[model samples]
Target: MSGWKEIILLEEKGISVDEFVSGFETPNKLILLEGCLDKWPTLKKLDRDYLVEVCGDNRFAVGPAQMTLTDYFVYSDQAQEERPLYLFDPKFANKRPDYRWIIIGPAGSGSSFHIDPNSTLAWNAVVKGSKKWVLFPPDVVPPGVYLSSNGAEVACPVSITEWFMNFYESTKTWKKKPIECVCKAGEVIFVPNGWWHLVINLEDSIAIRQNFVNRRNL
Candidate 1:
């Protein structure tokens, strides 16, 4: 561990666009910016009642199961069962053109450890609820994780809960901790190229996520 695996906070007020650009140039550092989306209207109207009134009728696949936004809200509102419903849809670019800007899902859901596709840098902005992010540097292979042929998927799939149950506690004894943060509403987390990360919704969360590539990381 060169330094503590912590994110650098860049406050939004008076922060120039060039400074934002410069921050991305340091590919090894994770950056968190607060108050960047304070004026975004979409962030304000993402609550359950609003989403149900707006998108309740539409049916979409939440993992292997299909359910409407109204049904999903009802399911998420109750206590979680042994197997939580995970709404990991990576095809918003194709299926839902109108809702392509952000990916929305309920609480008790999350993604396993994986890097963003195509060697791209990613920025995730939380709109409604909070998400807990567990990140490892690009060079550090997380414990209990094995890579596949192309190295995108893990050799054996593990849930965020399973990883926490089996591996998270063990990492505390290591020389460095994973880059961990709880991103609340109106904040953005910058994930650099090749970093492995697991993002879990700590609450019923709405987030807009995008990926980008630049000369330095390309």
Candidate 2:
């Protein structure tokens, strides 16, 4: 990757809210905050068994179909597809109002390029395993991605793995190369509104992601 660059990383304790606001407002860049969720109970308690015990019976959207957590786990364990089904439930906030999602997926499972809806900023925190992220700025549409005239819909490669195989290298020669990083457990990645991003799990993973509107982005 010729122009490859890493997103800025900061220790959570070292940056004040005011400082973060200032930097975030001026540059509006993606940032990786380390130890941001160290004190969250989910970091220590969230796992497949815990999730199954609490929400096992609740069905979640997995690709084109819905399945319970217990069933999804069984499917994921043996899934050998190029793009495995990922558990992404939008209605999770109804059960736990504080968060928007409890994402779970096996290795090689992930989302394709797309922007967050409603132009909201988001933060994704990995609780178990790790994820690799590739992001392009709002002005740059990622390679192999197509958007409708009204931007209401997106068309991209069939799978994350396919995109990487066919398009990832092209980004390297781009003047505005994508920001890339591997976010591990206990770390958080702040995605600015309108950034085009794709995420792939490095291994069987569990994560919490929330989208929000703040004064700067609202």
Candidate 3:
């Protein structure tokens, strides 16, 4: 599609923090680093039982929906035939006392197109399963994507499935391509400020993500 660019991927090796700041200055190009967060113990094993044991009754935010870990497990069991609700809990930060962690259930759970708040750059570390991310640059809006008046939400009338069905055809003749990536377990994705992104879980996915601004970007 138009307004999309191929995201760059780098293996975790001798790359330094300065190198990242220098390479990703455009705020449009996405950088994927594999094995970046493999050292985190939390990523070693992530499942319903593990989360419930670790989180207990902690509540998670799933866009407009909210539920506790205990309650979510019960809901998932009864709603096996339906799409699992995408749950992103900031409370997970309590474990590491660091950034927030967002949890999404089996295939079909994910977020729609939207921009991050405060123009902050972000990084998402996928601990388990896989996620498909479609990202558009700040200035280039994808075809058929509508925004709210204040630009905080996706105001389109169609559902994400319907948007996907017709998005390609709508942008077939465009010049820019939306940067896209399939982030797998043990990988981290760096998203620049102002990019519009939509993430769909390809399986039961567990991830820790945070947005921040430093002297480099400020």
TM-score of every candidate? 0.84, 0.92, 0.84
Best-fitting candidate, scored by TM-score: 2
- Cα lDDT tens digits, model 2, 20-60, are 77787446777889989888877889988888999998899
- When sorted by TM-score, best at the front, the candidate numbers are 2, 1, 3
Q: Write the per-residue lDDT of candidate 1 for residues 1-218, one digit (tens) a residue.
A: 32334666667885787776775545446888888998887778767688678778877567687778778767777847644676544454555333234555566687778887777888888888899888888887887789878865665357777889999988887776687888899999888888988888888787878777777767
Name the runs in model 3 displaced over 4 angstroms.
1-6, 25-28, 77-84, 94-99, 148-154
Cα-lDDT of candidate 2 = 0.86
Error of 2 at 91 (Å): 2.0
Q: Which regions of candidate 2 deviate over 4 angstroms? A: 1-6, 95-99
The prediction achieving the highest lDDT against the true structure is: 2
Alpha carbon lDDT of each predicted model: 0.74, 0.86, 0.73
Clashing pairs in 1: none
lDDT of 3 by residue, 1-218 (tens): 23333555677775777787776744345788887876877677676678788885777876578788788767755655433577777665555533556666667777777787776788898888899888877887766777778866765555556668878565556666666678999998888888888888887777778877756567
1 versus 3: better TM-score goes to: 1
Worst 10 residues of 3 by lDDT: 1-10
